[model samples]
Target: MNIKFKNFIWGVITLSVISSCDISDNKDVNPADSFLRIYDSHQFDHEIRPVDVTQTADNGYLFLGNYRRDDVDFLGTYISSVDEEGHFIRNTYLRDNNVHPVGKFLVLGGEHYFISMDAVSLQAYLNQVDDSARVVSTIGIGTTYPMYAENDGEDQFVLLSYSSVNRTTVLSLVNADGSITSQSAFGIGAGQEVEEPIIDHFTRTGRELPFFAGRSVDGTYYANGFYNYTLSLLFTDLSDNTPSGVIQGQLDQGGISSLLSLSGDNYAVARFNYGDQYANAIATLNTSGISSSTDIEGNPMLEWAYDEKVKMTTMTLGNADYIIIATTTKNQQIALHFYDNTGAYIAVDYLGFSSPYQLGAIQVTSDNGLAILGSTQVAGKFQRLCLFKKSESELNDLVQ
Candidate 1:
């Protein structure tokens, strides 16, 4: 066990304190100032699980998650704004009646926003929020549904949709103002295909997936979608959906699970099959032809259960760049694996004890620390949202 992990486990059980019950109890569980903040909803039959988190321009934090009630038909969304020290801000409009889950929270030009779905029409919407965490505006991009959405590291965002009628995956490059700049569609023929994405999960039909569509560091567009019936990363010309390169995978059973662009043509990728997961420190996907991802080689060939979610994120400190791979271990703890810019493995750190804490999203904070968002259960049953921040000094120690 890591020294940091050992100290944290003991600190949480013996030193942390909780006080003042409201909608959420803000507790500093560790005396060392490293503590877990659990945002609990005392209301019965309600559940909250964090989906995404991001830092605001004012140095505050905004976390979005799936908030659901047994009374509702589908899962709704909620956002909570907190200052740097974990003090609660006002109740944000993000917890309103019509919020959608399964979208990334983003900050651009100092503004906060994300994607949502209209429950009545099944229409997709882009929501821009104010500093106080209220909805400034919600714009529908004249689209019926949204299967996946991501910011392309540019001002524009890439969007994905499934058309059962045409049996195609619709791809669109959208601007910040909720308008489509370019659009294309790709998939296999209807009758010969395997399945149709659990019939678009939000429609109460089928299963959901780990989806992505964005641009590389070189600004070329790419997506993890069904390219000829297998879930592969498609390097495409945005206007035509023409594949210049394809990182191939097995039919519906295996594929790229997570991807983070490190540099031009070099990506930190995570791939998985039925029971095991692997990582590649550097994957060059800019060239043409099909590259199979069945046996990607790297450290931490973790045994993955069905509920585990894999994600990759990168950050730089001083002159060294670091790529972080985060996932839930089989022993039921979140692990963060560090790697150098050249994809060389470094060290591993762990978080969470006493109870099961699932990792949802990880972000490099403005001060070069880490902000982790996840969910945990109280009384071993009800679900609630939890957040914790790792200090910059701690991160610096890992890469040493």
Candidate 2:
């Protein structure tokens, strides 16, 4: 971590996300229990936004995001940490020429890991970061462009990447040391397609396409990405790279915007098409051994309609589990939707009203509080990072 104070301007701002946990401080507390902080940059004429956030064991927070410089040809990754009170601790630039950090962080056994790409070699690199926002080690995984990642629900992690040369979507079970234990490729068979959009992203031409790779409850690998040129969800047999079931989608119409796996096989899939949003409260794999669903509408959490940016995740409190869904509402504020494990609506809260805000990332703090990472347009043009923190009591009340 290199000390780079000439990068951003740190200040205070407000934000929120769709996540939660449980706790006792559900009572009155001092104003210090909650606050908002914003970080901006005048150091460089570029865009800085957060991608992932994690509450450290020491009750602090570590954030990872892309640092795009206007003059640079490629993107860089940044690591920032904050104390339990939301005070800044460290902000460092993890720079490597021509290397671009990919999507979300994969946390395993208390360690954080994310994939990056060597723009020249097209090789994917895995970076292991400590809780203190230090890059412990970085090793090359393969010549693949990483898209997304998640824990395997066991002890290791799984990575979803794309191979433009092969025109395929590659799934790999990644070991902690950046080793590929098992890998498979899709999009070579019938009705399988994982192509552009992903390639368009790293090329600085298209949006960051989201792809999920993990196993359902039965240990069957489930993934959702651009299948057949349309955003679709699929269940693949890693042994064969064959998709047994799929969810259909109109070409380029839409797919997963936000997702949270609930009990059993249910997944909360928030969707979007050309900027329109839909709330698919609860969804499951396409059964019949092999089939597809035109829609994931078993239990609707909210009235499906054109909405704002959406994100969701689960939080545990004592013996109960809560599902939190955060969205950029049409009203220009962040809506934190509270729900039970059963998909029942619990409550709703709002954050950020003075100016428009966009959610960057969100998660439950170690103390059952909430930490929301977002960005505000400062001076109507500068994209700055903003965060909102809530106390344990405030979190419980939302779930109640």
Candidate 3:
């Protein structure tokens, strides 16, 4: 109810309504129409939860998710700016008067990054915004849990903080006016608590040099079940903290939900799970070190054939070498798996929303198209915001 982006772009000419059932059709009629549901709305009074949607070098569309503010007791996490037809060009709310900002929101370059966590006061903030929403800077980086931020391009940024009280891995480097130019920690075990260290894909193998692929662990493996874990290969030097080489291994069973950095050399691709079943794992390292064994393409049991109750959550690397895997099954359907770059098995698309949709955040759109943010539900009573877009000939026919 406190939405503003110049009053929702001047109230979109008196709120242009278009909700008369077809539910935004085009669920796949081909002709270059690979599953279309362009912009569906559930209004917006309290729930419009989109947690991250980027692409706005003027082509428009920027959204960070969370809503629900009747004075704010809990639901308030947002940063929106839309236009490529999805309308709603301005919306910002990270709340304060007492604090209750959740977490995760990244847009990079044109700026807009977030990392808030205060479930009742665990306290954490590392916000930044600019592109008219203006906040420009804010940092406190302390009590972190779901952390992973990237943009080693020029203005510098790479947060990755996972410290379960000494189970190490800090690596800060954030500048562009937000400060902190070196933080470094990296250890991996003593108290262990690294769970889901994402970033999953970042390129550039020479000029403009950049590199990052993610997956970190040592603890919280299903509360302490599978042990031996390690998946690294971080060669950095986007202009400082020196790490021109690093390659480690030992997963011995499976448990790495995401990591991608293919073609630029030290090969990377991981969306793991052997105990809980999910698959699409591939790892490589140069200067001759780690050689890997877990491609799952030849059907090593489909690496557990999914439905282990939805949770392979994110992985991207496409543009001819393709390798996109986004899972959330158990009938909640959001699957999409295409492989290549040596893993084979190039096509699989499943989008069929319903049953409390849950596929939180995913990006890759410099024309290679794909921008998904999650949270859905309506007839059963309210909960909105589930942005969408997918085209590149429907991700190349779901990986041809």
Q: Which parts of model 1 are misplaced by more than 4 Å?
A: 1-34, 69-73, 90-99, 191-196, 203-207
TM-score of every candidate relative to the true structure: 0.85, 0.83, 0.31
Once superposed on the true structure, which residue ranges of model 2 sit more than 4 Å away at CA? 1-32, 42-44, 70-74, 153-155, 188-194, 287-293, 298-309, 317-320
What digit string (tens of lDDT, one per residue) describes model 1 on residues 259-290? Answer: 88767777888887765677887876544667
| Candidate 3, superposed: residue stretches over 4 Å from native | 1-14, 17-90, 93-125, 128-170, 173-182, 185-215, 218-258, 261-281, 287-323, 326-336, 339-342, 350-371, 374-386, 389-400
Give lDDT tens digits, candidate 2, residues 1-400. Answer: 1111223334443221211122225454543367776665533354677677777778777877777755445677777777776656777676565356755677777777777777567778888778667788878876477777778854567788777667767788887777788877767323333454565666656665556667766676766666566666666667776667666555555666666666566777776655556565566645325444445663333433342446787887556787888866664567787777767777888887567777767787766778888776665666667778877777776665
Better structure of 2 and 3 per TM-score: 2
Q: What are the per-residue Cα lDDT tens digits for candidate 3 across 1-400?
A: 1212222222443332221113234445422211222223424455665545666666455666656566634445667665544555556665663233333345456566666545454345567766444456666655443244655555665666444555544556666555666565555533222233221210111111011223233110011111123544334433443344444433323433344544344233443444444344345434223333343222333423342222222334444565666655555556667666676666777665444555656666666667666655655556655555676665765565
Give the range where candidate 2 is weakest over 10 consecutive residues by summed lDDT: 15-24
lDDT for 195 in candidate 3 is: 30
lDDT, candidate 1, residue 243? Answer: 75
Estimate the overall C-alpha local distance difference test score of candidate 2. Answer: 0.66
